[model samples]
Target: MKLNLNKKYANHTFHIDSYDSTSIQLHNLASLTLLLELTPRAEQLRRIIIDKVPPTFRATLPKLIGTKGKPILRRLNIVQQRAVLKAIAANEFFLIKGMPGTGIVL
Candidate 1:
């Protein structure tokens, strides 16, 4: 992404450095957003942290056990994945239950 603060005429030109959104990052961001969306206002001010992410995990879960990208968590059950996501969203969720450290949140 690039921005030009130059004042020029209609014949002027400009160039951007470079930028693009990766699917992995997009997926991660989307998942995080969903977590927030799931959280309610009452729990908004607490300290929360995501502890773990399971291997061979479902993309859009709380809805299903197996899934993938694009609308990742869309077709799954919103109920199950709700609490964890909600708590995180509220910023009151903490101490992830089963994270073995690396390979989680990727």
Candidate 2:
């Protein structure tokens, strides 16, 4: 029997050709495939993330706020300001999560 899938599933048409009932399938099977593909790359990134930042660099990051000026910082609340600072200071990656109207971008 043919099934009508959503347009979002269009990009994953290859899965239909490769379907196998013996294997376990999750609700978003492509996510599992993506995770598998990303596992090795994540391991590589983990090594870089684990590397220590030099003491001098870490010390200078706080001073940057003063030298760069505070016009932007003055507009944000305490939490948003801290998030922006952390994002700036991050060596590899920084993530901020907030409600839709919380303005994580600024």
- The positional error of residue 76 in candidate 2, measured at the CA in angstroms, is 0.8
Which 10 consecutive positions of candidate 2 have the poorest summed lDDT? 51-60
Instruction: Give the top-scoring candidate (TM-score).
Output: 2
lDDT of each: 0.43, 0.59
lDDT string, candidate 2, 1-106, tens digits = 9777766587664546354553445534754455446587655454544454322214347676866748888887887887777667766566556774375642
Scored against the true structure, residue 41 in model 2 reaches a CA lDDT of 65
Q: Residue by residue across 1-106, what tens digits does model 1's lDDT show?
A: 7655464445767555333657766787766676666466423422233434322323344433333322644653554355344433432233344444222222
Clashing pairs in 1: 39-86, 46-91, 48-93, 60-73, 62-77, 63-76, 63-77
TM-score of each: 0.20, 0.40
TM-score result, candidate 1 = 0.20
